[model samples]
Target: MFRQLSERFGRPVAMAILTLLGMWLMVMVTLPQLQMIDYSFRPNLLPAQLGGPEDVWTLSNYVTLFNNEIHRAIFFKTLWSSVLVTLLTLVVSYPLAYYLAKVATPRQAALCILLLIIPFWINEILRTYSWFIILAFRGPLNEILLALGLIDRPIRFLSGDGGVMVGMVYAYILFMVFPLYNAIESLDDNQIRAARDLGAGNVRTHWRIVIPHAKPGIATGCIMTFMLAAGSYAVPALLGSPGSRWFTQIIYNWFFEGGNWNQGAAYAFLLLVLCIGFMSLVMKFFKVGLGDIAK
Candidate 1:
């Protein structure tokens, strides 16, 4: 990799790039992870007694997570909710991606992309708050339904996880769309044309040709969407009702409210494990290798 980079750029520039990447891996990723793992193993202690005998390593934190029924339920709920969001996002994104990559002209695609990006230019917190406003019982959506005589009264959209789901899908669908677009854009037009000429229908063409070629993108997009939704704090905190508390909220409480950093680290470590396990499952189901997605 270094040799290829050095050839493309200069040796000095390549070395500089390599150095920056190394620093990022160590400082931003590896060190923090090591610290979290270290914290997870030790007992939660008073600040002054952190290095005292009472702070000895133990499995109590991990064991507590499994033994606590409420936390365990929250963890599973977060996992299932993230999976649902990922699947829903993929369903919505694949057609839009196909339209932009294969159906629309370059100018049209650019315009569509610009429209999509314009909303994201706003801060994510502001965007989530926008959903919170839109999903209130007397909000525009309910008013519209009432005006159309579709309903006699306002639906309580914010009474459950529905608002949070809407926010998560809205926030993360872009992640799915772009990957699918890039993969589909790289496909040869001739293959699609040839398939049609041989009497293949749209479903058959996508099932046999397009989908197989786009497996890596599907895997990457699903992984990204699921992880983002599962690890999400802001959207859920804003849109979720009391009944829809996410696992991350529990982790936050453990760290800040409970003043138990060890337990928080353990919970966080479990969430990380859940995400990695989900990623592996997606890759296997798609028959995509890590190298394929990297490409």
Candidate 2:
């Protein structure tokens, strides 16, 4: 890889780039992760207990997570819900990506891309709060439904998992779309034409030709969407009711509300592990390597 980079960009440039990347990984990623791992292995101590005999290293934080049934359930629930959100985003974005990549004219595609990006110009917190307002009991949706006589009363949309899922899908849909678009745009039009000429239907052409080409992008999109959804704290906190507990919320409580940084670090480390495992599984399933995604 380094040889290829050097040949492409010259040896000095490649060395400089590699040095910066190495520094970034060491300072920004590795050091923090190591610190978190250290924190996770130690017991929580009060300010007065600092440097005392009680401030000993232990695995009690991880043990607490395993022993607590509620935490275990919430952790798994967060993992699966994030997966569902990633799938939902892919389903909803693929057609739009196809349209942008293969169907729409250049001008129309540019317009559509702008429209998609406009929403992100706003603050994410504001966007999530907008969903909260839209899903509230007396919000615009309920008002319209009541006027249309679809229902006699307002539906409580914000008090369940449905609202969180909706917000998640909407928020991360762009991540899925852009990757798929990049992948699909690189496909040769002639291949598609040939497939159609050979009496292949739309479904078969896409399944046999287009989808195989888009696997790397799909994997990339899924990884990004799943990681964002799983680690997200704001959307779930704002949209989810108390009954719908997200794992990040649990981590937040452990760190801030419960004043237990050790437990929080343990939860954070576990989440990191789960995300790595998920990404590995996705790469294996799609038969795509990291090099393919980098392309």
Worst 10 residues of 1 by lDDT: 50-59
Q: Which stretches of candidate 1 lie over 4 Å from their true place?
A: 1-20
How does model 2 score by TM-score? Answer: 0.91
| lDDT at 75, model 1 | 95
User: Per-residue lDDT for 219-290 in model 2, tens only?
Assistant: 999999999999999999999988778999999999999998889999999999999999999999999999
Model 1, span 30-82: residue lDDT tens: 99999999999998888899778797889999999889998999899999999
In candidate 1, list every pair of residues with a backbone clash: none
Clashing residue pairs in candidate 2 (N, C-alpha, C atoms within 3 angstroms) = none
lDDT of each: 0.93, 0.94
- TM for every model, in the order presented, reads 0.94, 0.91
Candidate whose TM-score is highest: 1
Q: Once model 1 is optimally superposed onto the true structure by TM-score, how far is the C-alpha of residue 172 displaced, in angstroms? A: 0.5
